[model samples]
Target: MNKFHGIFKQLFELQLPGTEALDLYEGYYAQLYEALTSRDNYDIPIVMEQARITGGPVLELASGTARIVKHIANAGYSVTGVDISDDMLAIARKKTEMLPQRIKKNITLHKGNMIDFQVDEQFALVILTATSISLLKDEEEVECMFNNIYEHVKDGGRFVFDLLDDESFENSSLRMGGIDAITLNQSPIPKQFILMGEQRDANHSKRALMNFYSEVIAEDRTYRFFGSTEKTYFQYDAILPIIKKTGFKIIQIEKKELAKNEMIYMFVLEK
Candidate 1:
């Protein structure tokens, strides 16, 4: 990766451990939910609605912010949410506080690695929502993670996940464009944040590099962001074969016709 990409990745991956990642997310959690949920014809609710099918134990892998977990819990289902980032979980725990008493009692939270979270009891339904399953760093990790999910789900139970179809990326690649400059002044520690540049090709993949230069006024410390490309690109076609080899079956798909750019498909596999 180029210097800009490397720096972008570092900022996202490392600063979250010590900086305003958790605090910033906690502050804006509800607002983020409202903006994302209000978008018309989103399929997340469809997956959350499906979680009610058995009313049995439901485990959401990589459950960031727990927005769906809160909804599933409120609907009277036993839910357990697990995520890799403590920063994310911190915000998620705070959000769960808004849930009703009975639902709050039914929901449990665990912090662990997504590819290898250990649990004795099998769940009736296993879900990885909001394109989280695609976050695995590579194809090998993806296969292993899916295998792990397969092991955790009970027989006949379903594994649900959503992704933007590859064709969407293919189409968008042609429109490959850059972002306008915008300042994010939310951090107590000032950051010079910019979407430096982007490279989206016609075939399938797109790459965008973001830069964050933070100065912590109180601590007299300055650290360069460790990560690069806040938004990485992927081809859904490249991901599907890996999903199939991991023994998953595609059961239902929700294609957004209004905005083809926002197509989200749900993959359900029976174990």
Candidate 2:
């Protein structure tokens, strides 16, 4: 078996250490999301331009913490943000509460699953940004999500999203066995955290699983350790047919190369 499968099996069968680590890890993700979106240029310009062309009301799937949706609403579009994680939506609600009434009035938050959801109205633009498309684990889930998106968007409306290219996964170091430290200056727990893991694909599916363990040392030298696993699937050739089958015509594709042998692909599709 591949290293990822072995690690995942271990994680699944064993009791993880530090029950509080899950809460801390969630807090870490919330802080990271906030910091990434606080920048002026995060995902605002690209999505805003699409919203302007397509016209609103806009719907954002997997709108974690309302990072991009809030900005889109602030730009004067009526926006709805949907996320399955209530913790993330709670943070989004708190942030939305602080916005001006004009902007706040245009924003709505929903706690729902993206694969199966219904809205009272259709949208001119539907978005799934920040590599959110990869969160769907398999072809069936992707199909379900695209069908829902099709239903939610008006005819001729636009759907836009970004994904991490397959090349990145192919080129990545699958055996991350040693300590990997990450430091975020803006995070409340500013000290570095250590991560170790491996990523590998499943035998019967295109899905890839990443099994990781994280540890951090607090200021007082308290040690917190956490274990987590994530699964995502993406391939340019494989996903294109799926999108086409869902009745979306690909309009534009943008590619960006990042450091560490990673790449990003942005796709704009029309219903």
Question: Which lDDT tens digits does candidate 1 get at residues 81-117?
Answer: 9987676777678778877799898788998777999
Model 1 misplaced regions, further than 4 Å: 3-41, 169-171, 174-177, 180-234, 257-260
The number of the candidate with the highest TM-score is: 2
How much does candidate 2 score in TM-score? 0.82
In order, the Cα lDDT scores of the candidates are 0.62, 0.72
Model 1, C-alpha of 245: deviation from truth (Å):
2.7
- Model 2 scores worst on lDDT over the 10 consecutive residues at 16-25
Per-residue accuracy of model 2 over 16-40 as CA lDDT, tens digit each: 5442334322565555456545553
Residue 164 error for model 2, in Å? Answer: 1.8
